[model samples]
Target chain A: MNPAYGPNPWQQTSWDARAACNFVFGGVGAGLIVFAVLFGAGGLALKGLVLAGLALVGLGLFCVWTEIGRPLRALHVFINPRSSWMTREALSATLLFPAGLAAAAAVPGFAWVAAGLALAFVYCQGRMLQAAKGIPAWREPLVVPLIVVTAVAEGGGVFFVAAPLGGGGTPPLDALLGAMLLLRVLLWFAYRRRLAGTVAPPARVALDAAGRLLQLAGTLAPLVLIALVASGAASGAAAAALMAIAGLAAALGGAYVKYALVTRAGFNQGFMLARLPVRGSR
Target chain B: MTRWAMVADLRRCVGCQTCTAACRHANATPPGVQWRRVLDMEFGEYPDVHRAFVPVGCQHCDDPPCMDVCPTTATKKRSDGIVTIDYDLCIGCAYCAVACPYQARYKTQKALFAYGEPIASEAKRHDDARLAVATKCTFCVDRVDAGIEKGLQPGVDPEATPACVNSCLANALTFGDRDDPHSNVFRLLAENQHFRMHEELGTGPGFYYVWDKAAG
Candidate 1:
């Protein structure tokens, strides 16, 4: 990891950095598990992804306030917690992560239990974004299902590269990934069709950006994952190297999708633009 | 059942900004930030353009989203309909600012006090330091409180009927106990069926605007 990516030196080690780390990991981690469980082969590698997701959620609770004096004050959110999903997200993540982690890190005998916990965490994460009334894009009806599908697709891409037929897990896993990827394509159509109705320009832009990235990942990444997984099954060292490269691409592509959603696609320009009238339009 | 309210007659409101000036004086609000803003609304176009002065301020809604969304119990609805903010408890998050569809809340900008004492010296002071929390019309809470202490009606005072209502040369603005049927506001409400801003949102704002037949 680059030093630039590390925690800033000026702040307290346990405060801002912890919060930022929690947000980044919790967001990325749960997202990964959701993708994995939905798309990836059910096995030891899927278990690892689930554990990492839970860890991120646990860390998110530990570091709730990124730039506030009192972290304990976050408890007040529960007062109107019925209306405020931020509070619910906090509490759900607190429980979900630990349970999911235990399940993921468990022996091969209890691996199925861990996958179940990961599944629960993903649903809660979807609901959390749904609760934020301020962001129109996040609050959309399509967002929840799309989030789940995206998570599974990304997870499958990772699992495909890692798992070999018969040796790693069940043969049905590959078919499941292919099905999930196909479902993702269906979701892509659904999201775009819905976007056509949204009058909010910024929201439209953000959805388009997210939709484009997912389309790229769905089209190219899965083929690479399958190729690498198949090659590794036939050859040995060279195939493993190819599999590693394919995994990296999937991971990078996943990051790109997230980046598009969280940063560039989050164009709240409509809010400001609403304050102005079109001057040039005749 | 303390329904503190205001009634503004748009017919008499000349858009002269007298009420705006009076509010600015009473609140001693910093430059640019007005507790009450007079919005100039233009209808039709060209030769048919007719302007109406819409005085915008905190409506003190029955179901305020600001109070609902506030993370801390900083903003509360008084027993009276006045929505008051606890400055000490406010974390300055500005969530209420956005939640308010009216855009009633204004954050104190650095430009509000760029010249420090020199600019402030020219302006009347109301203990509003440079970077204070959100400010809005209090329905003259201080006056209403003082009047109640003096054993008078809750909202009426000889010296203070809210600076805007008092200073209105056209006598367009009205303030009284909305619960009292005999009150001028209640009678006006009965007669005119005044318009409430953004009535569709179900906020049930206390402020009512009586649009005159000629004005409309």
Candidate 2:
């Protein structure tokens, strides 16, 4: 049971690691679709990235299925698309998976369409978090942008690693990764600043610390690696090593952010007594 | 359109918690799961200390965040303003519990008795469907509905009224229709100064607290 003084008497967060994985994988998966479409890296590189992304999105939904009290009735999640964002997310995934397969098969027309659906899926994921009005941190208007930006950053990171592995390398991707990292860090700061006043003190502190950590490891480290590659300070195997490390750090950071937000800082709005109870005479 | 509401007169409440006990008995809720509770609030400095007993439960708002966020559409609001959870449909995601700012919702994953033993009373009243699902005060919807079908007014008839309202020894709790001009809740609201919890959030809560007589 939650303490009386804490934000909301219900201390248990509704969304746990399972739910966070749904967002992380879904976001990254969508980002990969965009990467595949933009780079036009067919053969193993495109197929592998798209397949991995689809697997991740599938895994995320599976994680949510495991979290529900009634696993048997999980299909009911699709029934309320008229209002529920969860349904919309599910609907988007249905389109994303088939489109991703087509893109992987080198269907030119399907690539852009898949990329579009992936973007919508990522946006829907952000909206899902924002719609949870009970949790002050989640409902912040900036959460939507933060989520979308983080997903893109993570997708960029994945492409950086996957491209080199598939013998397809591009100089522009390093710059793009740097830009995404900068945007993600900026969004983190803005989102944290927005939450400083409204969120519970403990939750605010936790988020602040987490956001800072994300900046250092997720954003700055990747940028440094990208800089090393550009400066010719690290070439051939060394540059590949740096890119891999940077990509891993960036992707992990995005996943960690989602985990912390869903489980740690996800405090409820707590109980509000309309009027202070009068003393003595009353 | 009868909108059901509860009015708690702060001046009259003695904070005996009889309402809590009655609610517990009526619902047969598992241990630690309280549908209704009385909060003992103390205010002012030591010398000027004053105590107030506040009975808190589900407000059953017109714009319920719980219903809106429910992925399974398990939570629903009645035409008469009662909010209910379809236990069978609920996945116990606790989304509704987190969405309710009033702390009105509760989720119990297991069945437990008051003591270590599963008593006869627990077995008789225990609902298997309620396990791992969000539960809260329905304003005694079963009683209200049954009474209405029998041509009895909910707020006026003791049998039709909520257990908490009927059990309040101080007569502090009042239940009636907010939309009805002749209803006790409407009359009380018209005659007294009242406040609704988190009214600024625009939830349009059904519960009202009559704080002062002079302010009305």
Candidate 3:
């Protein structure tokens, strides 16, 4: 055996705590920024929210980097700068940060373009983890697309809940919520298939819990959304309250999933041998 | 127009993180960042384990996702196929952060000024200019441009060979333009069992990995 291999039988180190910190904070921050866009707000506010979200996400990813090494030299992924998703992410972030500002500063369609690109930006966060070839939970094909759905859905819900508190509303807003909820349900169902065969038992249990919460959230979203669509034309506060609850549920549920994903039981093959001793050997 | 690429012979890579450190110093990157990370993936059962040191980075694919999702056109693809970024215009929104499959982009909460100025701390002075922006690797564009001016290889900026490339102690990393049939990177791609990180996403990464069963 190669002595330089560090420790053998190699035990894979699990840094799920750090990963969860990165995932939840980034996801929530991003969802909030995107949510701000749906409500009637200027580009300046949108830009600030997006920047705030970016800060949280950057801090999270930075923590992940420190777990490895020097954070300053993080630019090495761009050496080839062609096929690397990290590079793509870096490049996209470089543009998205400013483009969001430009959109905030621009007129009409430009703001929409910035918001649309922000949606794409959130999608990449999900894809980054989904692309991980090693982790069974992360490797599922459905993971990436589902992450997009959850990000948007949760983002929308968070937006609605916070919108009124900030003194903002529109007629079609609730309709948008209904649509987002529907998409989340569909994506959840689609992701169910991959969850069965690939995921570990602990992860499965945590996901099941999260799934149940989402279903409950999903059921209430439509009612609130449709009522809000009424614009004081329907059940009034009851609908608003329902939608608020749904949004809260979705946010909490998504956070649970993120936490579960990082904290759930799994093994890294590298660090195993050191953890468990041989049958008769020391 | 230069298309950069690298091939890592897993057999020769000692997993010493020389390339990782090399990348750090080459870029003068600030802190808590890594352009190249050596992921040691260990597979198999408890007693029969196997390990692999996979050096992952930007693929520089023929179709880059970063460019597709950039809202401000800040990320521009040059004629040579290098996906680059413009820092001045960034608003630090982090939309691109969400779009990336590789988790490559980073948001700058505060600016690193000419000297030791804390831009975030000095937000009142600069109108909060430094706190809201995004930053990342440019693939050493300054070096590439200088190399071109010197009549040297386009991507072969000797002074700025990307920390990871320069740090490979076992000579695992080979960098050159893939478009040049005679270049070292092309040759590595030509005569090796090469695979890329997450090829299914189809970002078409320029970085390749050559596996060695003997090393396992």
Candidate 4:
């Protein structure tokens, strides 16, 4: 490896904690909006969840704005749809907020519209990271699916956590959460293996640690909790409490993984020289 | 129809770093920000050991990732193939910095001088407009444009050539329009075995390193 400005095993510092927060809040918020509508939230419950989701998404965007050096010129972010994923993301947000408010107001089929737009918002976020061709971990083909799936899993997790406000988590929603948790863990392993040779050693180590947390706290614990709720093994307040704990685990664990993905594992693509020149070999 | 390019004859280079210093001086780059980096490399082992100084910077690629990923359209490519960043339009989001595979883009938020405060020379040349924005080597576009306005040839004229190429003591660096068959860069390229860095990424880099003189 070369020294300082050279071909060192470079870790990208351009997008740090600020960028990570965008993924954390934006993914979960978008997920929350979709899952709440899908699970049939109604009246005040529907309004509350949709508005809360929109607020989280807005806060995430605000954090990103704070990170920008020239925040005043930020509207220029919408200028490049022909080539930029970031531009697409900004454009998607323009439609998402109105749909979310309409759904919150219990407009006939606007809930579904809100759900669909939220899905697009989250999908744009995934593609945004994957478009960074220089960062090996982000550029992997599996990054898009992993981001989308994890966000869905987080959405389900939050639904269970906020169940009391809406009637409660149904058996079907519990099963869906279990399935998403399983899928997330499996996808993570596949993604990790695919990037075995590409990432720097430190990045690999950090990802491995996150993977362990993802499987244990995010996947296994939640799976067991959801099983208890589904099988009538837990009831009444016991069931709600258990399911809520599992949701917290799922939400927090997935957030940690995304944080790690954006901050810890974003090593830049260093150069690879196939041949070295000899000094005086004329 | 012109594509400007730089050719480096690796065998003739002695790793003196004159080009590096000349480039920094000419551009007035901030501390810890080097647009041109000469990576010292050692290859092989023991008795058969070989060494070379590999130079890297913005490739001025045909399909630059920096331009494609720039949310503000601040990064643009000229018809002549030189990639440039419009300081006025940039929002300093640093998206282009991460998109660049060469690690060529930099974003400095403040005016930092080399010796604590601005020296006499630094005070006169520092560009405050470059602060809080993405920056990289432009292949000295200003000099090229000015030289052209004066009806002077870029690659052939000492004043119009990039400072690094003009300051190279080993005569390893050459700059010219690659499309011009009569240019020195094209002649050197036609007579030597050369390769562009990270060519597999399909960047179509304008910088070429001539490795073997006999292969052509």
Candidate 5:
């Protein structure tokens, strides 16, 4: 196999920005479902959040549909759930969409089911990345946990920002978002460490830069904002504004992390020819 | 009960790329798509430099990650050990392309030609179903199957063999059933020290490289 020279060589991550959107939007959507189920105070606020989550998920699926080379054959994506994580993700969405809609419509006995399916959808997304064995960075065991934690963190961040827009805020959500951020930061560190040790040098360099950006923008910045909110250092209106800004940073940072991993850091294990011809006598 | 395998003797390979040309002609692959390729590697310092030619393609592993990740069940391994793709069933999601460790798969979305001209031979064999579908070498399954139906052996009969193996000018390439004790590949394995790429990953590749210390 030829050595992968130069920065940003062509890789085997056939899934492009559309696939990244599918994972990001779907994860955030699912996270919103879980957030509403746990902390929503009912009325239009809860309904709006639920509807937004459903739309985001629908949009994400549409993005994947557009990414497929043969869109007319996309229903085949649901055919192999027994083996393919992509099929399982599609199957889970079939349950999630209707359940989410029912929850948004204030139907009884649907919120819990929607929340459960949302979590399942997030899990399926992680598994899909893990199953891509050719990409050494994604195939790491840490990827599953990293993706799950980041999804929840992004979801919490979205809720924090969007909830304030409706003139509603929850104290528990602030604490929850803080905890998710902490976990996400820790997992990001561990995942990057493992990747740094194992991936090719070129990929490691890319991952290292991505990791530093995520640490500062995705982890530390939100952490400081969350601390200010928790310390009661700001007035009520000021705190809401700070929380919303923090939420945006966290959400954008999480999306950047996913985008970098999926696009920039993703690299296939290049071909390997084990033996070298002996020196001289050519 | 057959386990098809290929062996390339490093000492005999000349890096002439005849096998690459033959494979391209046999498959009628579009430009920039090579189902079989010879990789040239240079080793040692300038004064003592030597080059080794490595022929690479799909190993058709016992545990094929591509097969496992296919959302539409489009990739499957035959009982005889050849991995095949069902292009009709493939949605061209390219999941299998990234999942393959060997980088064996290719997806050609548009028709491309060599030398900026659509060659008559390529146009004649153009397959629309192949567009956007993942494709790779099949070890010449069509020839193997046809020859088997006619009671001919694969490694011994030119008509039944893979184009790459048949086209090897220096006799570096060999194809046979690894499970057969008397097969040429089995004999080569017994006489030469052999290695498979990424064996640590536990893919159990059907392709092998035979090396002799004396050749160096």
Candidate 6:
């Protein structure tokens, strides 16, 4: 009963900005590998994008590594696959790195293998938050789809931004970006509505700002840009530049929302008193 | 086949915090951490108000979320139903901290002292292994184990009972085996109307709050 942290649901201090960075980086990274394979990039462009995806995931894992209290015992994170989503994530990473390298090397049939592992990695990341029953904002069943869909949208955004830089020129990623972004926006609103009663008041306030940004820049503006590109308002470098801008908008939207979700909205389930005890003859 | 549990009679509690002091004195929990603390709550509006003191801590649930989310398997539930932590095996991920609905888990990276500096009492209990790992109430597991080894019953023996229960000035708190039909906890539950916190969450909490039997 610390007077400061008391009886109501309080924001959890267990995770900070670093934990948010993991999802931001890892989500885009995992999404990139899948999109690259699905879109069919070859030669140096394939290698470049795949390597970039693997690097981002590695960076995300490194961020978590720095936050551990006992870094020496980190290998123990792989010990509990029977129950822990985190252990499944680590195991997926072990497979993802090797498969990503082979795909980047243009090995036949490896791209699909790498993409599958990457998708599983992203899935594990989503489950990580859902597993925390104490945080009402996270334990919502909708969080899984929301996170997974956002990553795919962000990945499609990164694919458009990076694929054309090496002249590997994307094949109509604008439609894919629009599709994922729309889905994400819908899921975001649905998730917010679902958490209306469960989350603390402060958490709801934090989610509101992120929700606005996601709806505007992540979904609406990107759809407008895709239309302009299709109507041939600009072509060549100008068109490529517009697509990259749209992609960055989508990617950053998901990341900022995730950051807000982890840092600002992570509230612990406070004490709940169902009824007061009756006094004698009162 | 014993499931250790505790019950708090809300009518009898006075919000004195004597149990809190005893728990800290027994466990030497670092500053800002209370393994056992009573919640002082007020209900109703002006001209008609009532205050209630509800003791809160680790519920030690039958299905612990902390245990399921732990990647290291460092948190485990014993046969006696007390959840324990393996400090050395824990990587200090704080995953369990977020998983606990009762907010019972505590994790700190640095060794803390009660005074500005380490005093004689603080220096004697400087534990390095506990740092950077989750720690919480074990329902005084060590005392219960030792007492049991000496052929002493936990509910009946003052030495085996939790420090908080032993120090309760109002005699509001009781601890005993839940499965034992002849135990104090079983008798109390049979005689009184009680409720567990957040029962809707399906935590199956070991702690119970006794209100009244007449109302039921």
Q: Which lDDT value does model 3 have at B166?
A: 59
Q: Rank the candidates by DockQ, best first.
A: 6, 4, 5, 2, 1, 3
Residues A1-282 of candidate 1: C-alpha lDDT, one tens digit per residue:
111111111111111244334434555566556655544435566566676666655665555453333333455545445543344455555556555666566545334444554455555556554443333444456767766665655555555445443134333554465566667667767756865643255556665765665567544665555555664563554544444454445544544554454443332212110111112221
A68-146, model 6: which lDDT tens digit per residue?
8898899999999999999999999999999999999999999999999999998999999999999999999899999
CA RMSD per model (angstroms) = 9.8, 3.1, 11.8, 2.5, 2.9, 2.7
Cα deviation of A220 in candidate 1 (Å)? 8.5
The TM-score of predicted model 2 comes to 0.93
**Predictions ranked by lDDT, top down?**
6, 4, 5, 2, 3, 1
lDDT of model 1 at residue A209? 66
Question: Which of candidates 1 and 6 is the stronger one according to lDDT?
Answer: 6
On TM-score, the candidate that comes out on top is: 6
Where is the poorest 10-residue window by lDDT in model 4 chain B? Answer: B207-216
* Model 2: TM-score for chain B: 0.97
Interface RMSD of each: 11.7, 2.9, 12.3, 2.5, 3.7, 2.7
Clashing pairs in 6: none
Sliding window of 10 residues with minimal summed lDDT for model 1 chain B: B123-132
Give the docking tier of candidate 6. Answer: medium
- Model 5 gets an lDDT of 0.83
lDDT, candidate 1, equals: 0.57
- Give the higher-TM-score candidate: 2 or 6: 6
Clashes of 5: 0
lDDT of 3 by residue, B61-101 (tens): 56666665444555667776667766644434343543444
Candidate 3, number of clashes:
51
Instruction: TM-score winner between 2 and 5, please give it.
Output: 5
Best by lDDT: 6
